[model samples]
Target: MLRFFRWYCKPDLIEDIEGDLLANFHRTLRQEGPAKAKRKLAIQIILLFRPGIIRIFNLSGFQDHFKLIQHFVISWRRIKSNLTFSLINIGGLGVGMAIAMLIGLWVWDELSFNKSFTNYTELAQLYQNRTFDGQTGTYKIVPQPMSRD
Candidate 1:
């Protein structure tokens, strides 16, 4: 993770930030347990997976800003020249992203089902087996107490 962080971090801020992270990791390890320290380090590294934290590709010194503006201008001109194709691409991308977001939310909710309850740990789904038409079937809809308490 640290190696990935080094590869991903902005080149200008790598040295000082990496050193500080290492120092903080060691401090956390000493103050807290290994699990907490590892969690902290992992969280920090994950947080760096953002565009602002990633290294910029610009290498030119003074012309970088001009290059950026020129790049945007060229992009805008291309889009304008291919307005129909560009709109279609943008619409497809927007629909795909919206569908992906909705699926992600659904999966998150399903995984976290019943987690909001204070006594979720004590709760359990009850199941029962019954014979119907010479066949045995199991069902989770049986009426039963969720917890012993």
Candidate 2:
């Protein structure tokens, strides 16, 4: 039972919890008998399987952050040793990001055009499809009277 408890309990908390369980087991052993004491000990160890007492399977951010920092230092050293390649890689990345940002902004502007009007939800643009010189084209410049005479 002690071995079973030690297997699943968090390392930092094992001593305190094991101490309590042992104390209870001894008290039960004296008050009742060895049979009841062993049963109570088994129940106590099984009950300690709650989330608060379990050791987390994952490495916490503290350890992972140190690993990330170490990897970044190694990469910086490589980048510093290869200056021209690093510059080319960085410039290409910057240009690609800039182009992507510009295209995203243009798309947002196109989607939001004429959206500030009071009746924007009800507004629609009328496009005309015509054949000019045997070439077909779609145009949005629909002419209409602006005011009544």
Candidate 3:
């Protein structure tokens, strides 16, 4: 299998190489022992760089390889579908981040509003209820009231 992989530069040759390697490794293990088989397989893998060694398989062009073709087709399909989905995902994430940032800024601003005031310790909010269209609404007003100690 290693020989086949070293021979075929095409992507699809991976599966054939893997299968071949497994079959040869198992055969070697059965014929010899585990240690010898491992050593032999390792030697074969190492020797794969030798010229004219893997050329005996004579595999065709990369595009002719079924695995490469299948991968290309699948990738093309995903690219088409992912274009719109990816845009939506990015837009949603951007909007969500912006909203979160704005809320954080608002909270920070509100908290810091009275911090620099000279009468910060005496600051208080007064709550008043008003009726409009038969509905009651409550609002808080600054500089309104404080509790006596």
Best by TM-score: 2
**lDDT by residue for model 1 over 1-149, one digit each (tens)?**
79889888998888988888889899999999799998999898898689888987656766988898999999999999999999999999999999999999999986786898987776666678999999999987856564467
Indicate which candidate wins on lDDT: 2
**TM-scores for all candidates?**
0.42, 0.46, 0.38
What digit string (tens of lDDT, one per residue) describes model 2 on residues 1-149? 89878877899999999999999999999999999999999988887899998887776888989999999999999999999999999999999999999999999987887898976665567788999999999999756744342
Angstrom error at residue 77, model 2:
1.2
lDDT of 3: 0.72
The lDDT-based order of candidates, best leading, equals 2, 1, 3
Clashes of each: 0, 0, 0
Off by over 4 Å in 1: 1-62, 118-143, 146-149
- Cα-based RMSD of the predictions, in order? 22.6, 10.5, 14.4
TM-score of 3: 0.38
| Sort by TM-score, top down from the best | 2, 1, 3
Which window of ten consecutive residues has the lowest lDDT sum in model 3? Answer: 49-58
Candidate 2 displacement at residue 84 in angstroms: 0.3
